[model samples]
Structure formats: C-alpha cells, structure tokens
Target: MDVIKGLLVLACAWGFSAHSAVNMQQEAKNISDLSQSMTGSKEALNTNVISPLSGGGSLKTFDRKEDFSFSIGTCSASEVFLKILTQPQSSGRLRLLAIEQDTSLDGNLDKFINVNMDADMVCSNGIMQCTNVDDFSTCSSFKWSAASDRTVGLTRVGMSELGGCYCISGKCGNALAWRNLKQVLTDVAGGISASLAAVNPYYTMSGVTVEGTQATVTGGNAQCATGSVTDLVSTTDPKKLASYQNDPNKMKQDSQTETASSWAYQAIQSGSLNPQESSEIRRCSEVRQPIIDSAKLSDIITLDSGTGGVGYCGADCIMLTLGTVGDNYWNSPCGEFGAAARFFIKDYKRIKSAVLEKAIFDDWIQILLNGNYIWSGPYNNWTGQAIPGQCELSTSWNINPNVSFKHLFNKNGVAEFKMRVMVADAGEGYAFARLTADLSCKDTKTDTIANSCSVYQNDPECTLLEERVDGVLTFSSGAITGLNPLPQSKTISQDSCQITIQRPWFNKNRTYRCNVKTQSDLTKAIARSEKIKTSTTAKDYQDIQFKNGGIVGDSGTLNFDNLPTVQPCVQACKVRKPVYPDVALDGVDKGVVNPTHYDVTYKECSVGVCPLSSGEELVQACQCTNDFAEATAIMQIMRNAGQDMICSTGIEKPL
Candidate 1:
C-alpha cells in the first residue's frame, strides 16, 4: 500500500515490442490507484494506520492472490525498510513509523525511493538474496544501523540487476543481464542461475520445488521484450556483483536460547515492545531473583523461529524458546494455563524490545477450568511503585499472604496488570495459585460462542463429560454425584483487576449478557478457580494475529477444536464486457466474451496477455495465475503449442 508515484517520459526502449509508451501510462494509473487504495486505514493489515495523505480511505478487499505490501518512503533511514527486504510478514498489527529509517523526515525525494517487492530480497549491485528469517545484521536490513560497508552485504542492491526500469516508451528491461531473477555474473563462479538462464526461469530456481513455501520471478515483463534486461545497462561496474559474492558469511547460527516468562525473552524482542510508554516492559536481568527458590521445572519446551518471522536480538541463529516448565499436568489440569509471545530481532547490538500482547483467557478459558465446577477470577489489588498503574485485588483475599496482592504490567503503553489467584472455597485452607499478569497465553476461538467438545478422563468411574469446545478438559458427568455434584460461584473480585464470574461446568452461557472473562461481568457473585490462558488464541483472538511462534506460513495452521470449516469465500462483481469485443484471434479464445480484459495506453507492456509472466510469478504472487497444477501444466503445454496463449484466474477463496 505504501508506494511512490513517478511520471516517466519514454526515451530508449529494449527487450519489448515497440509499444512501451501506451502500456507505461496505463500501468501508472493502475499502480497509483492500487497504492493509494492501500495506504492507510484501508491497508490489508490488521493494524491499519491512517496517513493524512490517505484521506482516511477504505480498505481494499484482497483475494488469495493478494499480498500485503507497502513501499517505503525512507529506504535509507529506518528499520521498517530493512523489515521489508529481510522479513516480509507481520503477525501483529503495526505502525510503519516504528521501523522508519529516519524519524526526522529531513531527506530529499531521492532519499525516499520505492523498492519493488517480489519473492526475494533484492541485494545491492543487482545480486538477489532472500531468507525466511529477518537478517537484522545486514545494512540492507537497516539503512544506517551501522556505517555502510559493502563487505557486510549492506550496500544498495544494484538497480540494473533488479531489472524493472522503464526504457524508451514501450520497452522494459532488467538492470542486470542474467537469465532470470538471479544475475549472470561471470566472476561469481557459475551460479545456479547461470546454467538455467535460457531455461524457463522458474525451472532453475534454488528452492521453489517445495509446496506452500515458494514463489518465482521470470526474465520478461508484461511485454515479451522489456523488463530486467533493459534496466541492467545503468550499472557503472559490471563486477560489483562479483565483489559482493566474495564476502565471507558474516555470521553463523548459534545453539539454544532461553526465555524467562510465559512470554520468552526472544519473543519479547521480536514483538518490538516500547519501554518508554505507560504499558511498558521492565527488565528481569537487572533485578535479582530470590536465591533460595523452590518451584523449579525442567526445560522441555523449545522456542525459535522459521518462515514468516525474524529472530530477535540481531543474532540470526538465536530463537525465542521457553524451556519446558513443569510436566503435562502443568500444561493445565483442565488445560487453562496458556501463553504466547512476539520477538523482534535486529542486527544492531541491543536487547530485543517487544510488546508481548498475550491472550486474556477470560470466558473461553474459564469454560475449560470450570468444566469441573470451579468458579474464580482476579482478586482486588493494585501496586503503587510501578510507573504504569496496575489493577489487582487490594486485599489478596486475606488467604495467601506470601503471594503479593498486586503487580505492575503494561499494554500498548497503557497501565495494565497480571493477577495471581486463589481458590476460595468452604473446605480449602488457603491454596494460592501463581498466575502471570502477562497477556501471552491465547487460545480461545470465539468469545461469544462456546466451542466445547466432549471427552472422558481420570481413573475414576466412567463418566460422560463434555470437553469445553477448546479441546482442553472435561467437566461433570451427566450422572452427577461427589466429583459430579453441582457447585456455584460465591463471589468475584470487586476491584479493578478485570475478572469474570463463572459456574464450573455450566455449559449454558453466563448469567448476564455482558461477559465472563473479566471481573466487571461478575455481578452475580460466583466462584470458580480462575485459570490463566495457555495459548495466544483464547479471547476470540480479536486483538491477536493468527500467527505466533507456532504459526509457520501465510496459511495458518488449523485448530479444529477452536476453528471449524466455513463455506467458500465468494463475491461476484458485474462482468465488464470488453468495451470493444475482439474477433477470433486464437481458436480457444474465439468469440469468447472476454469481458474481464482491460486495454493498455502504456507503451511499456504487452496487450492480450496474462498479468503474470513466469512460473515464479505464477506461484507466489497475488495476481490471478495459471499456477494450479492442472492449469499450469496445461499452460506449459500451451507454451510449447506456441503463439495462441490464453488464461483465466481463480474464482474464489478456497478451503
């Protein structure tokens, strides 16, 4: 959505038919409209910011072919620029300014250039480099994080090599003259691209063969003649690319990493939390832990990053891992305890700063904990020492004196809290549970709708229990008795620590219409063992991204228990019959309505062709493509069939 618009005056043309001028004009209008439509509140991202220039625009509805992209206005000044080139996805909503190269806004237009995005990281001097993890150490990752040094893979990617400059009205070309996306550097010692230059570009790529993990770029543009080839002539030195290839690998991978809280340290940094604000994070490294500790759990849980994410702490090797704590039982007697975290890794020498917006289990998680009939929520408290105000039970229920009544926490710079709870009952002495105020655990699918399933557990008599749709635990048996007898909530936290009142195993919705996740909804005065959330999907996932440390690709993994199948996504737009229908040009296309086609006024591109140009383009891009196995295999045959080519795109959002 973020992009730059420039007017082009056709001059020299190459690699394309002599129709550049007409095509160029049309492309300009298309790109401008697209970029303008996606710039602010209308952007595809969950956290859509409104730029004044965007005029509070509406969001563009994207299909599966659609991708999230916004060009940088400050390529040389901020980390946001680096994020685009290194790691291209954001699991959470973000403000572009957080990663801007220069907050000062004192640079010229040349300083603010548009970097075209594709499947790869376009390196300086025309050589291309791409990785799933964010390479925070590279200057290309961050314009001025360190002094510009070519040996560090920090220099500007060669414009000629990137290969998309406009040449004369209708022609396009690549800046670097290689067969495809990879350059044909002679001194680079026979790149994989070298042998495949003449081959169908996608056929020669290093890693596109794998499914759900790759996309490609080809050698040609809209017009068969113009594209990367014409753009490569502008480079002053041909071997600049060779020099880059010679640099030794700057860093290597490391061993395992450690994170203290339910939200690990590395995850914290990756999330890029700002500490100066009200809802800020503090340091545990600086504070001393009680030397004499009792609760100790061995490390069983592993934390790290793979595709669609960057490791925080700048070291490419390190990943956020929370060593396994407790045993399976600790996972949650009823599967209540949950956790999630975000990390922002950078190459610069600085501890990763991240905002860990953990899920607030509230009602959905409550269903699991109380499925056995225990109603509980946050206590009445507060802490005055912290910069941000914390809402906690003021009295600590007068039960467990050792557990503090309140603690400080943050949420987007606004004061927030993490609560430690206790089970208040007639029989129990004063059993207090240690709960993190950290909002890391999220795993609830719907806050409004219950997603409980049924299951049987324990060695006692066979009991028929309903697994609260979350797939966590089972509550009372239909035939009730001792462990089966009914119980009710006594009272809930009467203070600011937002708590929820729930009756254990009460399948029916809460008494009030409001909610059961927070204290405000406890007016009915009930009791239940307040259980903490265990994953990042508990609170209707409203404020959460489908992605987390557990997520792997653009298509998020499924939680059959939390999320269920839905009907195919479809919306029909009126077919626009071509203004001037074309007579039969190809046998298959003869007399076809072809109502979807648009004309070209730009001399830069080809008319009557698929929007896509190559296999790589067909695979990963947002454009309607012929990449479907049967469709693309057929297209390949058609390519061999020669001359009369025609194609159609996807019709809907698939399952």
Candidate 2:
C-alpha cells in the first residue's frame, strides 16, 4: 500500500491502449483539471511584505541601485513567517534580509547585492497590504514547514520534503532573495522530465506492446511513443528471520513427553497391588492370633499346572475360580480344605488320557489312611472325555478343635500341592485347579476340649498320625473326643459363627503380580505417559526451516540469507473486447474495427520503487514484512498439529 501513490501515473499509462479513445478523453479531462488547480498559484502567494520587483516583477536585478528594500506594511514579522526555521534572536524588525552574489554587479560577477526589509506589512488570511498602499492579493495561501537546512516546500510537499526542490508545473511561486528558488525548481523539473523520457515507457511509446493502449505523462497532457516499462519483483531475505530457540511452550511439551514415557515404562516393568490385598490386610489386623488367614493363603497360591481346572494359573493356561460362599474365605479352619476343577478342553481322547495330580492339602490338618498321614492325593487318571470335567476332592479328617490354628504356621502361609493334569501327547488340556475352605471354629473356653480331650488322647482308641513329604512334616492328625464323637461342629456358611482374623501376612512378596501386561487399560495408560515424554523433542519448530537451507537467526536476531524467491505472480487483467465483433485472425478478432491483442509484462511489487531505479529501502521493508508473515504461518501450523509447546502448570481448564 505504501508504494502505491508513487506509481499511480505509471500504472495508468501502462494500462492504456490506443483504440481506447474514451479513456484518452478522460485522461485529457484529468490534465485540464490539474491545470485549473495550478491557475490559482499567483493568488495563493503571500504578498504582505514588499517583494523587490524589477520593472515587470522579475526577480533578477541588474544594477546596485535597483537592489530593493521594503517594509512589512501593517503586521508583525512573526505573523508573516509564523514557522521560524531558526532560534528567535529578535535581530531586527526585518523578518528576512540578506546579501547574496549578483551576476550583474560591477567589477566581478561574484559581487554581492544587499536586500533589506522591515516589519510594516499587514498579511493575514491570504491578503497582504502595505502601510497605505493598495493590497497585494493574487495567490493562494503559502504553507511551509522548517525542514533540513532551514529550507521548505510549498503545500503538502512542504510537510514531507527532507531536502529538495520539486515542481509539478514549471514554476515554484515567487523567487525570493534567500535563493533563486524559482530557477532551482525549473532546473530540477527539466532534469527529471529528460531522465524519465529516456527510460520510463510511461512517457514514451517506442516499445508499445498493446495496439489500443496509449502511454501518457503524469498530468495526462500528452501521449508518448510506444515503449516498454521496466521489469522488477519483490523478494525476502531469509537471514533476517527472527529466532525462537528458547520458547517456553516448546520446552514444556518436550519435558512432559520424556517424563511420562519413563514413568510408563517403570509401571510396566514392575507390578502393582490390587485393592483386595489391602482389604485383607486391614481385616486381619483386628483378629486374635491362631487364625488361618485365607487371604494370605490365596496370595501364595499360584498355578503350577492346568488351565481353569483346579489351581490358580495364567489365562492362556488355567484361570482359577474361587468357590461360592467359602473359597475366597479370609479365615478358614487350619486343616480342613476342599477343591474342585474345571477342564477347558472338550476333546474326547485328550480328556480320557488326562491325569489329575495332587493339587492342595492342609499343612497342619492330616488325613489318615490306615494310620499314615496323607499330605497329597494319589494320581487319578481319567479314561472318558467330557466338557468341563468337574470334579471335587472329599477328604474326611479327625479334629482337635481345642488347638488354636495359630500354632500351625508355615513361612509362606500356603499349604498346597502343585497339580499338573494334562493329556500326554495333546498340547491342549484343562489343568486349572481351585480350592475352598470352611473357615469355621468353635471356642472351647466354656466346655474346654483340653480337660475332656486329655482322657481320650491317652486312650488306645484314638491313633496319632503324621506324614513326611520332601523331608518336611507337612500334616498331622489327632482325635480329641472323650467319646466316639468329635467336638461340637462349626459350619462356615453361617457368617455369625465365623471369627474375624485381622493379622497382615508376613511375606508381602506376591507369588504372581498383575500389571500392564495383564490388563489392556494399563497399556493405554503407558501410551499416554509416553506421549508427554516425547512432546518436548520438537520444541523449536523454527529449526525445521533450517533443514531447507533457509537462513534464520540462531540467536534472537534475524538472518536474511537463503530466503525463498517467490516468482512474479500473474493475475487476470480487464479483457479488452473488440468494439465490433468480426472474423478471427490467429483465433482473435482482427477486423479493422476490432482491437488487437496486447501482451505486456508487468510486476506488482510489494515494496520499493517499481522499475527499480534506486535505493534499497523498499527492498528491505518488503523482506522484513514477508519473513515475519511466513514465520507466523508456520507457528500456527504447529499449533494445529497438536505439537503445541505452551507450558502449562495446573489441570487444563475447559474453554
């Protein structure tokens, strides 16, 4: 937008065509209007102070006697030159008076003449008058501002000129004694016109590309010969791009991703506790000693063989199902336990060849077969195939309820035998084994079994029993009834009859742990954590531009080298239709009344003087603007792609 005003004249001419008589007529009208505007120049001049006139008002003086002086008629000098270019010294009533070289002076052409003036004029609101003489009012108001070297231009130009003389019409108002301002204006204009004529096609038609288009001067006063305009384009320098190496947003994303991944990996490698384990610990803490903690027993009971048949096992092998009402018992009788199994395989041949090995037995409670303790069940081989071959092991044992279960302690808590029931040659088999227990106990405090069982223990009717497995005394059975009946029975199905054991297990280490490997939900948690840990690696998105060899600042400054070169983008211009439709010549209307096709190359530069004759200000300005735009676009893309690097501290709030 800033470069538009300077090229208006060139643009209009370049867009014209000779057959466009209507446009030419409008251009002529435009020149007429410009001339009419300048016609008031004489009336616009400031005339309160006497301007030394040479006969017909010529500024040139020929003799020393002809050197003039005047008095500012009625107004103060300050009002005449309201904008003082220098510090006020109150030197004299004369607003401006000086001596300068006079070519016509005697002896030498360098001889000088003196011009003086006094504040005796009344000049206000575009009218000037001497003390008693007639008023001098011919030109419009003269406006100026103090610029470099204390020089000023007229009207709007006066507000912006740094140091120069410019004339649009041939004259520059009245030439005062300060300098030959009028001549300077004329010479500058002449030089500009001559220079433009040689290179600016807008003033010449020698290389005209369009048949109907006509090139004209700025005021549109005259048309030039056919000619070509200069070709120029805009470009950005990459080295000037700003740096973003230390942006906080990018760093935060990177940090989050890294930390999350590490935590996820750790969670996967190690295991975590389940809520049920904590509940068991809390419940056991309140109960009395001598209690068989079923919760502790469960923790140590891991699968040794079989899937979904009898014991605890992996899902792919055997999954254990606790029995209803009593299997997941927190506290159970020390020596009484039960087991049932569900085989996963339905193959007739596989089930027939399947073998059921010893799965679970009490460590303290002993089962006697002919006075020998039985710590495990003998191998039972099946011969018939059946789906989910459910089986239960029933073992009856003698009880000494007078003894508290706390006396029966194994370091690992679990009193179970490993079971591996599988078909000999078949890879598929149901080997899962599960256990259940009736955690019922009766206090003998009121009817002490100790006093009554003492007599029976010494009798020959009750036989003491024991068993040895792997050199460990795993089971022992004893009878404590004075008569042929056991102590009053306690059933586990009645909750009110059960005792609450509240002691935590001594060995907290799990026989089998569950984690991300066992649960799909935990796997997703790990993925989310990893996302956070990897976010920061792409912190400095600006660095990506460097891969393309673009020069950007490694520091906070800018680099302009290696900037991309955008080709001159073309656009559709007004289609010049023929005045009268006719036959075609080269696929176009070429009748006498039809216009010829015109093709002229032009550039819509973003900055700088088009035709690029001089200064680099436009070039630099355009480069800076374009580079910043590109950087912004790239950053937005990153944000949209979910690579936002903005640092966050608390939970993200909803918009």
Candidate 3:
C-alpha cells in the first residue's frame, strides 16, 4: 500500500506542473498580443527593454520565457503588463510585495503594491490582486545598491518560501490596473514637479487699495523732496538816474547841432537810413524812459523825475530833464544835455496815422515808435553852438500798406512812443509835445454754414442708408428715391387686333381702345392682354396696376379668363474651363505616347458668374473662369489628408 501511495503522489506532481505550464503559456500569449497591438509589430515586444543592475550593466528582460520581469517603457490603456515567476507554496498560494521609486525622481522609494497570486503565477482567481490601486507609503529602510543608476532586483526571502521576494527598484508591480494607475500618476506627478520647480517666490507686492469694484495700485520706486519759493528782482534801481552832470565818467555827453537834425530829416525823407541808424535812435530813446509807463497817454502834464517837483511846462505838456531835478526855468544850467519821455499807445491797432506838433525850448528832438525811428526834428545837429530860439516842428507818420509795420504792435496792440531831446550848449533843456493820431477802424463780417446737411441733399448725413446702391435708378435732378417707375404707355397687337392704353399722372383721364375685325380678334386681344388697370373714379384715373379684370366705366365691362401672362426669359448659364499650364498638372505632356489624366474637369456653370441684368457689362458680371472643380477637389482632399499624395500630370514614371 505504501508503494501505491508513492505512485499517486508522483502522478499528482506531474499533473500540477503541466497545468502551471499551460497557464504560463496563456499569460505570455496575452502579453504578446497586447504588445503587438500597441507597437504594431511582434518583434517590438522585447526591443530596447533594459533596466540598470547593481553591477553597472543593464539587465534586459520582458521576454516570454524570462523569470520575474516587468515592462516599464511601453503602456496601453494606461496599464502596464508584468509577468512574475514564483515557487509552489504549501497552501498553493503566493504573496508578493512590490516597491517602486517615486515618479517625481526624488530618490525615494515611496510607491508600493502588495499582491497575492496562485502557484501558477496567475493572479488570484483571475482578478486584480493588488491591495491598493494607487497608494504611496514610506519605505525609509529600502535603499538601492547603486545610487547612480536605477537598479532592479528580485531576492528570495527564505529557502522554504521561494516566491516571497521583493522587486527592490524603479517602477515594478504585478497588478495590471495598479500599474496603469501608477503610470498616469507618474505623468501627473512629473507635471506637478515641473510646475513647482518653475515657480518664483521672491516677487514683492506693492500697496493695493480696494473700493467696491475698483482697485488702485501704487507701485515702483518714487521719490519726494521739500518745496521752496524764489523771487526775481531787477538789477538796476530806477530811482537812481544817470546823467553826465552827476557822474561825468560813467555817462557820455550828448553833442548835437542843427546839421545833425538836418541830416536825420534828409535821411528819413530819402529812405536811405540803414538799420544801424534806426537802432541807435531806439537806444538813445530807451534810456530816456528809465521805467516806461504802460498806461495810455491822455492830456499829458508836467513830467517829474520821481523827485516830487513840478516842471517849467504847464499842465497840458510833459516836462523832461537830464537829471533827477525838474527844470524850473526854460534857460536852465549851461551844459550839453538831453531828456527822454515815453508812453504806451494801447489802442495802436485803431491808430491809422499820427502827427506830432511840438513847441520846444531846446536844441533838437527825435521820435521813435516801438524802437523804430519814425520822425526827427530839424535841429538835431550837435556841431553848432546853442541857438536860443523857440523852434516849433510838426512831423507825421502813417502805416504803409506796401511796407507792413503792424508787426511792431504786440498781441494786445500795444506800442511804445518815445521822444528824445538834446541840448548842444544848454541854452534850453526842456521840451514838450502834443501827439494827435487819426484813428479809423471798420467792422468785419464773416458768414459760415453751420450744418451743411440742411442745404445739400448729397451729404452723407442726409442719406438714410449707410451705403448707397451704385447701379439703381435715379431721377434726372439727382434725387434718388430707390424706385423704378413703369413706362407711361402700353400697346398690344396680335392678328391685326390692336389695343392701346395710356397711363397719365394722378387726376388724369384713362383712355383705352380696341380695334378688331371679328369676335375672334377681340377674344385673341383679351387673351393676349397681360396687365390690368384701376381708377379712383369713373372720370378721374389713377395709377395702372395688375389685377383681375373689372368694369371700366358706364360704357361696358371687359372680363376674361385664362389671360396669357408674360414669363421672364431664363438666364443662360455660364461655363468655365480650366486654365492650361495648370499648377496641378505641372508635369503633364500632351506629346507623350501615353498620358494620364488627373480627373481635370471644368467648373460648375454658376460658380464664378452672376445673373446679369439687361444692360450690365459682361466683364462686371463674370470675374473668374479659371477655377476647375476637379483641381479644387484634389487640393481639398490633399489638404485634409495632410500630404501631397497625388502625382502631377507631367511626372515621368521610372523605367
């Protein structure tokens, strides 16, 4: 009986080995099919499958017959296929532990998958045996043999438990679903790692004030400083008047005579005085008014040199002197001297001409208008001795149209009038002047159209439509009502039966007549009639219309059935032929013995041609006739396929 039991045990052992081999073969076939579907070739299953080993060389596996292996490079349906080999256990079951490195490449073995399998290396009951779908747990004790490379190893835990092993490195697992989930998680983790690595944490925030939906941001570098005020004053004091009598070294003595005045008057009359002479006159006049008065000159009186003393002149004239002291006597101190006085002409624009009549008890005098020498006295010479005489002179100046002097006036039409006096030997040192100007001005009229649309109908704003119809009908008076009025009369003739109708304007009479030889002719005329008319009253006629026939007047009523109506002519379709020497048929040659046609055809008749009116130009109606349907179809197909798959007509075949 012991011998019989031994035989039975041996038979059971052989049967069990055979069953495991079949299961292994089936699993290998499944992996091969999956790889074939994904890589499109059976040879790609084990191609380039490598993993780093502890000793520095790569361990290439994933072959159908390899023991304890997994595929890392290829994935399908977000899952990876792994085949693990194990020894038979006493309970006919296997417990497997898999650990994988973090997909983030942090050098940590954080992801793990624990699985249970049968002795035949098949998952338990053909179901997923992984405990966790996608869970990462700390494995601090796990360390790689070589830190430089991702090494994978499978070590047997004990002699009795042969299948109990650990896959010590880089992504390894036995559950297909868990492996696929790990692949997806790995991609997500990689993206997150990249995103986190790209972030910059050193940016600074500026001040922000939020009020309701508005936000005001005040940013960037700004600086502030204290404020102060500055005052500008004139360098020269007006109260201290300069004169040769007070300071002989600082001021020059004026030397004038009758010859100088005569020469100045002759130069002005001949228009030979250069700009230098004019500038000199202005300079001498400028010092006369130490502080020019901008006020308008009214009835001038005595001129005081800021000394609070009256002059020798009366209240109707202004007195000027060379020093700060006002002259009390006409025959003043005996010395070569001069005086100056200035006043502003505020209404200079209205001043057409000015005449100065001066009564002087002095040697010579000159007048300047805004720095230009306009007139001078006759006794302006400095060579002769003083002649004690009351010299009276009258001079006039006018604005010449040929020579514009308007620019001398400022924007406010203000001008300065300066008068300078010189005493050769100090016989008399005082002078006075009376200026009378002829003021003439006229009122100007300006007319303008505020809104042009009210006067011009062609203005864009007057038109109701944004865009105008280019070819539509318009009235002869340039009025466009966008309407097509019918003809004023109509005549119909058939088989010697004539009918005439006249349509006049509103409140006009309607006239119609029919000439026929027999009833047949009348019936033919009625049948041929295409239009119907209407009237507001029996006497007064209105517009013509097309409707069912009715009573015309007390004369009679003409009614007919099945009236023949005019039918518009059908438009002729346009045909377009493909242009020769086409790009699509670049290589085509008609002279070749055997030529291929690339389905070249004409385009549809209506593709590039519009329905033209009775008088439209042919060029305007049809613009494009070179586009072919077949070429267009070919180009569209090629574009959709993302490749130039069709050969041209003229391409030569290889011999």
Candidate 4:
C-alpha cells in the first residue's frame, strides 16, 4: 500500500478508539464543573480550575485583581450595566471586585467590595468578612475604590448609597430565572433600576456591537452616572464576556453589547458583580458561545460541505470503503451512502405534467453520484477498498451506476446506508431502503427512530414495529390487495432527544428533514467526515427565551401560560407608503411615491419590531420619537435583554 493509504489506515483506527472511549458522564461533568469550584482551598480570585481533560487536578476559581486587571477595556463607557444568573452550587458572599487585566486574583486585595460587605467586615485583623451575608440592602456598590485613583478627588456619592436603590440578595429561583431577576431587581431597587441601560452610567460597549462600537445612548435619564471614562482594556475575553444567544423570534439580531451590558447591569444593580460571579459568567459564556455561533450560520455550511463520503478516497487514502444498495453481504463496510428513493424517480402522471420540474431532482441526484466525496468512518482504514467488491475510484457511481444516497455515515457500530434509486418494478418508480443489520436494540429506553417518514418518505409513520412486520400479510376483507412495506427509520440516541423544535423555520415544514435527522442523531457518525451542525442545549433555549422578553405572565405566577401583549415594535416604527425608486422609505420621501404605479398597495419600511402574529401589517397610529433611530436600536437591545416594553406609544416613547 502507498504511504498515504498507510497513514489513512492508522488515522481511522485512532478515531474509532477515541470515539469508543467517550464517556457521556464525563462530558456533562466537564460542563457542570465549569460553574462550581472543585478545589477545597479558600475562595481566592485567579485560581485556575483546570478540567480533567486538560490534565489538571485543581479546581478553577474566578479571576481576581491580583492575577488580572479589573479595568474595563477601550470599549468601556463611564458606567457599565450588567445582570447575573446566580447558581446555588456554592453560595457565599462575593468579596472584592478586582479590576483585573486577567483573572488571577492574588494580592490585589484592595479591590472594590460590596458596600455592604465592606461595611459589615469592620476590618478585623486586616481581614474582611461579611457580618450578615443575608442582609444585602447595603451591598449595592458600583464604585471604584479610592485606592484606584479614579474617584479620589470626586465628592459624588455612589448610587448604592442613595435610598431606594437597594442591593439584590440571594439566588433567583424562577424557571425563567433571567426574566424573574428583572422584576426581582426592579422591586428590590424600588424601580430605581428599571433596566441596566437605566442604571449603569459607565456601560461598556466593547464586543457588544456587531462591529464592537458603543451604541448611541441619547436622552434617557441617567440613573447612576459614573462620568465618562476613556476606552479601557477589558480583562475578560470578549467571546466569554456574555451569553449572546437571544431568541431570534423576539430579538432583531444578536447584539453582543446588549447581552454583556444587560448582564453587567443586573450584576451591579443586584450587587452580584463581584470577582466570583464575573468569573462564573465568563466560564458560562465560553461554554455557550460556540453553540450560539454555530446555530447562527446561514446554511450550516460547516457540516453540509456539499461533498459526499467518497472524498475519503483521495487517491492515496484507500483504506476507506463504500458499498452499493442491496449488498446485504457487505458486513459493516466502513461507510455507505443513502437517500430517500423518492428523489430519483418520478410518477407517470406527475412526470407527464411536469417533466421539466422533475428534471431538477435528476440533476441533484447526478451531482450526488458524480461528486467527489468521502465516507465518515475511522481514518485508520478500518475497512479497505473504495467500494466493496470493486476497485478504488474517485467516482463511486462509476463502479455502481444505478445507486445514490444523500450522505454516508456509520449507524451503531455497523455501517448503515440509505439508498435513493429509481427502480423499474416499484410502483412509484422509486425505492428507499435502510440497508443496515438490525442489531438487537439493548436499551429501547434510550433508542428512538428519527421518524423521517412523516415528512420525507410520505408515510404515516416510521416505526421499528412496522419494519418488523413489513412483509407480513394484511387481509382487510379476506383478500390480499398489496403489502404494506415499512418506511425507513433513523435511530436517534437518547442524548439527541432533548427538544421541542428550535429555529422557527425547522418547524415550518419538512424541507430539510433528512439533513436534520443526519445532523442531530447521527452527529458522531458524520461529524469527523462532515460538518454536522450540533443540537442546541437547554441553556440555549433559556438564553433564547430571555432574549425574547422571557415568557411573561401575571407577576409572581409560576407558569409562562399567560403571555404579555405581542407589541409589534417593528411595525410601530415602520413608515407606510407607496413605492418610490430612489427614495428611502423610513418616514422620508413619503409624498414622493407614485401611488398609481406601486406594485404593492402599501410599501412597508421593514425597520422596527414586527410582531410574529401581525405578519407584515403596518402598526397603525404609532408615532416615532425625535431620537427614533437611537431609541429603536436601544429598545432592540433592551428587548433582547429580556426587558418588558410597553410599545403602544411607538418606538420613541419608553413605557
């Protein structure tokens, strides 16, 4: 064998071994451990809690001023607003707020402390400890220490010192924890802290914008003005700054600044913006950023590279093998290709009506069979040859002319193939088959079939029960009309079963059923070979919920059943008129449009918040504020931050 072939063989072996060794418990623990400290040592900032995968035994701690610089970055404003979700793993009083350049909190003991913590401690033996950790009324402190020199000469009292704006206490227990915090803090702050935008004057705009610019904040009352500060260097990584995954259904876009600012607002207002909480938020942000970014890619291009499994055959890599449809003798043949058979053939009646339309399907199948693709299996050549019982070829279709599959992947430990082909004897002139041995499913509790038949195969259901009885005789009137063949089944592991549809369009129709099944359930099988988009996590759903104003109901209610009014802020901000070629539709050139020559009766300026229910209707009788653009952008940020807005007054007016 050639050197390339030899290398491929070795790589495939290692991949299989690695995959076989993956422990689900370890994976969950890895994520869970990120939020809590495992080290038995005292809570000091800057302690590195290395994960087991990194070969470290120490528990990771939050960064401190000793180890990191606490100064905000060049993107910071005079005041920064933040919110924090408190987890109850190891509840303790947040000590110093170290303005660190990095996360190491050693020796930078003169950091900003909770005003309450600072007051309660009384400096016994140079050690500060909380006298009453539960009484957080005095904890609200967003002040720079006098030692820091920023406020040395200023006589202004901090917002926390003012009456009415009290500190937030304890962990929030709302199922929609993010939403509840808004009310909890508002009531706790006595409406003094309505939102982060309202409270924090030194809000940083770093890594918040699509382009990392501070959004224009025009005429809103400054709740706690910290005065202007030049661009400071943020100690934390921008990627791990905040949870940016907002509900696309509610928020206009993923504004990172809004998320970061909102979180900071909550933290400061709630008096939870300390070293420990900051570090935890950073960790959670790091864990969640990739998942959110992946979900945003327009076409899941990373997974669906538009190539097939044959790419593995790269002339030198011949250890990989592919198989044809109906090859029952091909035992676990490394990799195989399959698709819904309906793709290849056309019914006579539909064909005669739209031969041109059916031709598109033929083109797609031709690309699949002719495309240079590789199978997803071990890179170490677990199996040899390009196709079973055939010589290695870049085009697998050259070896087996009449078969095609959408993608190739391993099912269980065995290579399961899906075939889409035009069969002369089949009634629909097409046949779809799942050509993989049915290894006895040991744990039916965790095993689930993809049930793709409802959408792709045009069957009532795709069930193993039907698969078992496919050829069984069905006598409906003591006469045999035809056999009821079982539809194809895509087995979904228990891990992939956590959902109700995400991404609104995924629930719209069956346009991408086959791809969704392959990506979600058969992720591991195809991930190495293809860019399979992973499923969203429970945290993703919460982040999305919080982005979309967080499922509001009657205050203090347990359920999200009673939703708030769907205010179409986008509609409220749009300018309604007829079309004009050279004129901008945003309340400008309204009188310039030729009414008689308009394509649509009412030309809509799709600018602001449009309710999902109204579709495209223009919000009637709402007026724009003087700072409409700024208000619109800020409102989008606030709405994305889960702040409830009463939009009956239009974009300019804030309720």
Best by lDDT: 3
Q: Which is better, 3 or 4, measured by lDDT?
A: 3
Error of 3 at 258 (Å): 81
In candidate 4, what are the lDDT values of residues 93-144, reduced to their tens digit? Answer: 2222212110111112232322222211111011122335345334333322
Question: Each model's TM-score?
Answer: 0.13, 0.12, 0.16, 0.14
Candidate order by lDDT, highest to lowest?
Answer: 3, 2, 4, 1
**Models ranked on TM-score:** 3, 4, 1, 2
Residue 182's lDDT in candidate 3: 27
> Residue 524 of candidate 3: its Cα lDDT?
28
Better of 2 and 4 by TM-score: 4
Please, what is the whole-model Cα lDDT of each candidate in the order they appear? 0.24, 0.26, 0.30, 0.26
Q: Can you write out model 3's per-residue Cα lDDT over 6-31, one digit (the tens) per residue? A: 33433333344433655655675677
lDDT of 2 by residue, 335-440 (tens): 2333322222221111111122223321222222122222222222222222133232233212222211212212332233222222212111111122322233
Please report, as a residue range, the 10-residue window in candidate 2 with the lowest summed lDDT: 79-88
Q: Which portions of model 3 show Cα errors greater than 4 Å? A: 1-332, 343-350, 362-446, 452-655
Q: Per-prediction count of colliding residue pairs?
A: 138, 75, 11, 67
Question: Candidate 1, 254: how far from true, in Å?
Answer: 42
Q: RMSD, each candidate, Å? A: 36.2, 47.9, 47.2, 39.6
